[model samples]
Target: MFLKVIKHKTAWLAVLAACLSACNTGNSNRPTDTPTSGTIHISVDETYEPLIEAELKVFHSLYPNTHIIADYKPEAECFKDLLNDSARLIIATRELNAQENAYFKQIKISPRSMLLAWDALALVTNRENPDSILTMDQVRNIMDGTDKERKWQIVFDNPNSSTVRYIRDSLNKGKPLPPNTMAAKTNPEVVDYVARNKAAIGVIGVNWISDPNDSTSIEFTNKVTVVKVRADYGSEFVKPYQAYIATGSYQLKRGCFFVLREPYRGLGTGFATFLGSYEGQLVIKRFRLFPARINAVFREANIQ
Candidate 1:
């Protein structure tokens, strides 16, 4: 009888030990940070500085406990930070490719990504420059240095910026930039260059000059004239307005993607969720960019 009692107690102790072991394993896999709290580092493509700054400002106001440290740099640098594990989240123009997916799989992390907004590249020139309308063919010619007239000088925010990559991959068809293509350090520098040089045309993100509520953006618009673009010679020229961007009238449109490498439900995931949420989408809409995550309705209006 005593032997039977000893065996039963041993079984009970074993079961208890197994339960504790499982609990420990689960706790180890749990995330250290919660959605509404904790500090995190993130990298954002410099093209999105104004839009993201507005987002972070509102996020901080809503969740006082959470803090996000953002580093705005060229798009290539943003990806490097993600690959090196220096940033938990990154705002980029594109999502991960096959190689990037394999790298994350090897690290035992399944990265998450979502489309946040539809962005556009603005072709800006000096206010005094009369050539403000361009067709897709003419723009291509200017970029490839085939425009025999060479009427305008081309400038980009940075050599490694997504704007340069977009022009090369999408418009230039994987061709190298022309020898005369200039590189400014930042988007603001591109604007400044165009503002000062009557013959210079700057390629920059639309968000820089699209924010009506932002004083800096308003000032930028006043400094340089945004060129209207048509898909072809006969199509109507359209600006990168939200309505036009939504309807595919704008010719140089791209997507804004938010990628997170977090292994658990951390602050990075929280911020990514917020970017797709209705409130966040509203913020993106206010900046004049088309929000991709939400359904937006537009109506035509006439004024007397």
Candidate 2:
């Protein structure tokens, strides 16, 4: 009897020692997996910062555990960040060019891109100005500096921006824009410049004139008026309205892109998916930009 009791006690001690050893060694016989949580770094162009910031806030609310760090820079610099592997994702107004794609491929990083939404390039003038419309030819002449007379005062959003490129491309067709047109350092500067100068016409993104029901929009409209661009005779010169863009009436529209490194997994894939989701599309619509996917069913149902 004594021997059996002693054996039982020794067996219990051995089992407890094995369990404690496993715990102390930080090795479990069962499968052990750790949860992943980290910050996602995103670099975006200044042109799309406002919309991106708003979208990020909503994203954060849904993903409370994950953190996002956003860096806003010019489109050129944002691309540089991606090339340097400093950013996981890049949001910009334009897609990567052939040379950029080649660079990524050379570096063993094939880029994946998604078109999030379409934004229009707006031509604006002081509210006090009587002219409310402009033709593409007139705009082209001003941008190309071929007008010579400077009859139509022209201003660019920024010196190194797609806005300037658009103006140059649209006006020059294949040539280059003249050096006479004014290039502002920032979007607000362009807006202020046009607001103060009645003769000047400022070119900027349609996102600047967002918020139809807000005080900012009212104030902007009161100070400056958006110009209507006419592409043809039957097609009336229309402002950059959401409906107009959705119907393909706006001729100078550009698609916003989500550019990321290859494999398209992790943060890059997640961010792109969110941007293309219904909630993200609605956010774009709220910013007065046109979503790539048209929700015709929702539109018709919402229509009273």
Candidate 3:
């Protein structure tokens, strides 16, 4: 279960979607009871390795009999797993598009999608680089492929990753990505690359480098410093800390979604619901990402 989903775990393990009639008829492969125990595979966006891995560790600790094989990849590949039934459960940044829904409908797999967490896209640079703050305008210009005077190299976890899509579409507003953009195989690679290259800036999910209490995040902090981003509508420059992400001060924020294509209350349903439960929300909070299912408050009071 402690698989390093760093660069790549395996090639696309595609499979056929299980039909509804077969599942409804109490198929031998699917669960029959409340589904507290079983072996299943869940696909996840690679950017979420830190938080998702933590959650699964606790889940497995609680349910010693249940086994969950997690395949972490770029967002597009995760969606492919969901579509082909190689993974009945997936954690992604968005829900199924209309065409994806239509495809599932034809296959008789009604997917249950829900928001699990709120994660901000974090920009990072080497500790030696003194320029730590980036305005949303500068961010847009860098990705817009129009600025020639300011040649900043931008790196992402993967080309098809949600972080890339958010930076390219949400930030650039449909502008073509600049030729200076680069893709690392994984989030850690982005951090490592930025840490080694003073001129490069890396974009990643906040989950990777948010929590000070987390050992992995602490290592990331030691490697490179997270870049503070100025809000498009405000003057304050803020990092992707929990407070900034929750208060909307961090501009490049996105949602975490769990899309399950389970016909019955099987293992997929159980795990999906587990991710939104109270305990689950607490786990997410510890990682510094906002929990979507439950209310979490962080107050600021002067110590005097």
Candidate 4:
């Protein structure tokens, strides 16, 4: 009887020990996962930082329980973050290519891509510079350092930036950018460089310089002039306004995409879907970028 009682107590002790061990190693046996309510990280192209930051502010206000961490870098680095699982989403100028799609297939993940807004690659010059208008060909030649019209110095944010890539692929037909391409650390720096140098032309995204509601825009434009660009020779020059971009008059417009690779309905999906929502589209318009889906209100008003 004594032996049996001792055996029973020992069994109870073993059971209690197992329970304690399991309790201490909470969720250790379960796979790591993200949910809509938890914290998550994303990567964005630095060119679009201002817009994304606004969107995140609104998103966080709405979803107070969810915290989003954003790392703004070159577009290439954003893609790398997505592949390495360091980021659940990436905002960039382009979608994943066939090679990237194949890698996702091999990894048993399907990347979701959504176009969030229409943005333009704005060309800017010093406010004091009289050369405000340029033909697309001239711009291309300047980029390639072959423009004999003037000793041109083209400035861009980063060598690997999406702005540079877009210009290179669109204007140069996948050719390498010219040696005259001067690199600035950021779009604002590009503006600063152009503002200080009379011969420099800064190529940047329009959002950085178009929002009248934002003081930064005033500061940027106060220092430099947003050069009007013609689509081709003998074409009318146009600035990168929302109307111009929407009407296909903005010559350097590009689409911004949200590339999400979340396997489950996680925070990434939530954010991507939020960006495509009507409210999200409104946010895009508020930031002076044309929404992928038109959602702006138009109320007729007469002024005397």
Candidate 5:
């Protein structure tokens, strides 16, 4: 009986030892949470949502463990979110200004801004419209409501949009946008307006007029015809093709930036790296935007 009791005690001790060993080994083997690999809260400008969404889908496929919660807002709203530290990432057409950069530095988070892609500011018109090309000066005259011939009727989204700002800055040359130019609340509304108005020309980001592979792109192309813009008569009235934008033929182009509050070390850093990587740039190319990589492939593609 004494020997049996001793054996029982030995068995219990062995079991405990095994469990303790397992607890220690399991903890050591478990994956650690990376600052950049976990759930990331990001804000995206509405104009870039489709491209971002497509890219995110590809990203998620590769890193299924990572989660991204994205809020789509206008560029101004995105900047506001970044300022408040409400988002770890902001994808927009513009970069931080000096004041905004100083604010980030004050907060002890000097953001790393990456220019991922180039997008064109495209002008659109109805398919039946005879004029398929316009000079910068002609667009300016129309926006200023000085073109008495009414050869170009202007239609666009909200005044706060990048499209409006580009037209106002480029065409108006710092002058106020003319009252005759119509402003719709949304891109779809602008498209609808232009579709119904034969003479009206809609100005929007080139992403809207992307090719038929993507649903949003198809929708825009079906509704309107993208007009070519020329710097002058000798220069080509180049449409916003990916190759054209990449090679600098498309003059009205903007950069898409990813602004992080701090030098991303974890998930933020990882995502930033991904955006600058070949795979991310491939997604950008697929969206018909000019990727920053500027590889030979980008030069060869005819993405119109």
Candidate 6:
């Protein structure tokens, strides 16, 4: 009986030792990155470069110890970075689909995503272009390859950009872009192309030309004419103004989202949180995009 009791106690001691070892190992494996310090890599859709750049500037100033390296590319490549574990966070126009969530689940990493803002695509043309207004039907015709006359040369920032995807999915009904559509390396390039071309209309994020505080954006705005769009043949034309974006009056509106795969409350989480905070939403408002996380009232009044 004495021998059996001793054996049982020894077995219990071994199990307790193993459990303690595992607990210590798990504690050691905790991520080193934190909200106020540590470095992180994030991917952002290039269309949002200006907006994100401004946001990062403020973030870095507030949290001087934290560093975030951002890779600006097409929305598709941003997703690739997140899936391959090269980036801890990604800013894009849409959230992950069912497949993406499942893949994260399989990897034992539950990703989180939040809507940051309501963004719109602006159609900009050369100052010399006489046609500065378009109906949704006309825009659809241009995108679906039905405009045989090819009245305008359609330009996009990139073939794989979120702008292209938005048009294809929302306007073209999943159909591919027209063969004659032109793609520039960046939004600025697209604006330059349109500024120089007589018949080119560049599709770009509203933020690129909407920021009055940004000298580059003002220069681009001066170089091209922002086209006013109407939802239908008989509707009123409207530019992608903040009030219009908030009220869904802008025809090319889409939601901006940040998808994070951070394993802890790291720098990525800090930055993501900032994007939805009051200060961050103020930045978004300054850029003329509609903030999703903040409340703002719009009233109709006639201008003098």
Ranking by TM-score: 4, 1, 6, 3, 5, 2
- State candidate 2's TM-score: 0.80
lDDT of 4 by residue, 1-304 (tens): 9999999999999999999999879868453434447788899999998888888988888888888899999999999999999998999999999999999999999888978888888899988889998888887888777788788788989888998898788888888877777899999999989989998899888889877788998899889988888775335888887877876777788999999987777888888888888877888898778898765544556998
RMSD of 5: 6.6
Worst 10 residues of 3 by lDDT: 7-16
Each model's TM-score, in the order given?
0.89, 0.80, 0.88, 0.91, 0.81, 0.89
Q: Tens digit of lDDT per residue, candidate 6, span 21-66? A: 9999999988777988888889999999999999999999999998
lDDT of each: 0.91, 0.76, 0.84, 0.85, 0.78, 0.91
lDDT of 5 by residue, 64-88 (tens): 8888878876677788988987887
The residue pairs that clash in candidate 3, if any, are none
Off by over 4 Å in 5: 1-36, 151-153, 298-304
Instruction: Estimate, for each residue in 1-304, the C-alpha lDDT of model 1 and write its tens digit.
Output: 9999999999999999999999999899677678889898899999999999999998989999999999999999998999999998999999998999999889888888889999999999999998899888989999988888656789998989999999999999988878888998999999999999999999999889988889999999999999998875346998889988887788789999998888788899888999999988998999889999899999889998
Off by over 4 Å in 1: 1-32
Best by TM-score: 4
Off by over 4 Å in 2: 1-37, 148-150, 213-215, 262-264, 296-304
Candidate 5 backbone collisions, by pair: 35-267, 36-266, 36-267, 36-268, 37-267
lDDT for model 3 comes to 0.84
- What does the lDDT come to for candidate 5? 0.78
Model 3: per-residue Cα lDDT over 88-200, one tens digit each: 89999999999999998898778899999888888898899887887887777767766565567889889999988887778777777888889988999999999999988
What is the lDDT for 129 in model 2? Answer: 82
Model 4: lDDT equals 0.85
